[model samples]
Target chain A: MQLQAEEYELQFSILVKRLGSWLSGQTGVAKAYVTLRDSQLLFLVVTKSTKYDSDFEDALSDLDIELANDPDLRDITLSVLSIPNVPSDSLSSFMHPTTNFEIQRGGNDG
Target chain B: MAETTVKDRLRLVERNHDALVALIEDARNPHDEWVATIAFYKAIQLVEALLAKRHGSVSTSHFRRLERLRVHHKDIYKQFRPLYNASMVARYLCLPDEPGSTSVAYFSSFSDYIGDAKAAIINGRLIQLEALVEKGLGEPFTKTRV
Candidate 1:
């Protein structure tokens, strides 16, 4: 069922946190961030391993049934982002500087 | 509907690669952050082509594209995540306060803000993808029941 924009974000964030917690129990998963953007569902994960082999495929596909059955999320396009274990000190390094710059750029575009 | 031939798919891969190259060339112009954002998206398309060739299907959904990438092509996924984040930054998401607000002047200085290190990371991703494409998508695997 569809929800208001605010409600959707709240529900989606809750779903993401729950899914993230469940995924953390699986081997090799460091973290998972479930988010919806532009009508697509994104599963951005950080992992202990960088391999997307048969084993990892199994882990991802295992979610299909659960995700497909969910009333709020089943209809959207789903995507994933898997990254290797990055040191905590370097975590912020993953974000684009321009993104931050753009936000802080503010009314100073002149 | 007639199934798309391998030749046709390969042609699409070539097109994606060509577009990526063009975006890279465009990124060399001034206002690089703006250009780099576009380049990152083209890079995603290029990876999608590679993944499509491997998987025998294509998706218009970004999430599905990334999901399959992580499931099937881990190597590319490693190179792609940061680029994807960078693209998100370029397009929207990961902002300090206001979102989706971008300007050349603001991001022009971003090159200096990131200095050489982060720039290297961004350029490094493109290089890795280019190398992968030059290597070509290898033989497709036949599925077998586990």
Candidate 2:
């Protein structure tokens, strides 16, 4: 029973929103977004700290466990970058995609 | 930006592989953190090379690379995830031991913190990945003199 492309996209969007809400509450995560690059889905997390501290690692480990346990998102790949790692132009590029969902600092939905 | 060819990616793979070998063979000090990091980057290059050769384009990011592997090459993905996690631990969490503190610790001994055993495990995983890459690319991946 293969899902239609539209149905799959809808499901993906719903899941991303739920994940974004969960990520917004996570400590040390300043922002999180999902973007399609080269036809592949990417979950990019931007941490508040410039360094990879214990808090960031804890949040990352928790996210990994959560993603692994989720049936739908277990197979999805995720990337975590500190604020310093993201280039200025790339941030805009990440936000350009319509499918992208960003949860900014202070839990502001973007 | 110019698109990277398979040759360019493989060249980067070779360079990282050479650096891994050099770091492992260095006699002065044992820095397992660096060893883990280099091994992971080498694996990254190998994956990128495979993607470029097979799909005609490399991944735009780390997660994209892993996603490409997960969808197209599950075996490589399985081998890569542990290496990725290990490197993250080595780079960020495995801190140096402090003196005479009797608190519960994640890693107690200096060896436990990215030690020889951990380094050996990471190396073994890297070799497994290289074998897979060689099978896919039909070329030798390890070019270290030692």
Candidate 3:
């Protein structure tokens, strides 16, 4: 499933290059990070906590999409609810970055 | 023949993870951090497989165990810098399937990526994760849609 063939995630910075306006439109947070592994795309969407819920609510409202739990998340379903509660230090324990992938060198502490 | 169920795989992984945890707790002579890194990810894929398969048999307790495991693993992966230089996305997820998407350029091949750096091994294996994530990135992924 890893798309080593084309290196799409590596090109994700290209998304920033080309889709910044589109992204800012979708997320008023003004900060987002997208990474890919093989075929799996890891989208790290961040916003101020104040902005976080509002933006998410707004985005879904505009799209008229219902936010319900389903199979697409059938695998990662557990951690989905747990993320908001993630404390700063526990972030380090994952053996991965604290949150989403960083868009810049020093963004996410990893 | 006794074929392995995703549940069986999960149990094996839990066993292996516990074994590694014991090694970490050893008092006499602690192994280098790299040894633990391998153990962490080896255990990761087993859980990844169960989650990926979406086994019907997984229970609330199972999810709880998995959650504890994932958060801790996330903490461990955060410890190192990429052996090579590259751009990546910040961490955030819109939904359950989307485990925070971002692009990263590192060792494309596991073996070649590590160089002589002992710590680089983990980055090497992270190379395979894309296979898992790409499956859930977009509209096809938004769990509720299904």
Candidate 4:
């Protein structure tokens, strides 16, 4: 069944919160920012890992699969970013400060 | 880091593509991980060339490049995502089991692991991506050798 607009929005919010909490618990994830752009949900993840690092890529692939498997998120155009690849200043113009997820104490050893 | 020109990126595309072709044709060993990794880099260069042509600059990071593709070139993004994931698996997760251990006991089945078949699949995807990028750029990729 197709979700109504309001119901979809509610689901999106819940999913974002759940994803944020889940990401906080992941290894190498420091902070994550959520934002909507061009009708796509973007997660800007800050990590100590460099681009193309094996563990980082593994985590990303896993996340991609997880999102794809979720019925609520399957149809949504979603993109996850590892922040090192994108400068924070460049993203700040579009990503609001309030969207930052609450990060845990010690998981940034990528 | 200095910004690379479209010409430079395309040159890199050719270099990586030729290297991929050479690796695939080697008779001694399949070199699955190297094949997959090279194919991914070839795809990256193709996307970077397109990005340079369209946006006047290439992305400095992999995710940023992916974001550009996702936002501006959805078709390419669809093709590129699988290539990226496959390369990740080939490079990181695909490991040889103990001498007497069954492959089924590991993270992946033997047939599903990064082997000749998976490398071929990655190569096919890279070719498809190359065609798409060439169409978008209105230029044929120069292949020194196939």
Winner by TM-score = 2
What lDDT tens digits, residue by residue, belong to model 1 across residues B23-74? 4455345443554464465566566556556666766676666656655666
Model 2's TM-score against the true structure: 0.55
lDDT of 2 by residue, B1-146 (tens): 11357778778888987887778788896666777788889888888888877788889877667657766786676566656755765654422333244332223322354346333535446777777877887655664332
Chain A vs. native, model 2, TM-score: 0.58
Off by over 4 Å in 2: A1-110, B1-4, B94-103, B108-111, B117-119, B143-146
- Listed per prediction, chain B TM-scores read 0.59, 0.81, 0.31, 0.80
Order the candidates by lDDT, highest first.
4, 2, 1, 3
The candidate maximizing DockQ is 1
**TM-score for chain B in model 2:** 0.81
> By TM-score, is 1 or 4 better?
4
Output the lDDT of residue B83, model 1: 62
Candidate 3 chain B, poorest ten consecutive residues by summed lDDT: B137-146
Better of 2 and 4 by lDDT: 4
What lDDT, from 0 to 1, does candidate 4 have?
Answer: 0.61
Residue pairs with clashing backbones, model 1:
A78-B63, A78-B64, A79-B63, A80-B67
Interface RMSD over true interface Cα atoms for each candidate = 11.6, 11.4, 17.6, 13.7
RMSD of 3: 17.4
The sequence of per-residue lDDT tens digits that candidate 4 reaches over residues A2-98 is: 7578877766665665566667567766457667544456666655432334345446645654564566664455665453322344345435555
Error of 1 at A28 (Å): 22
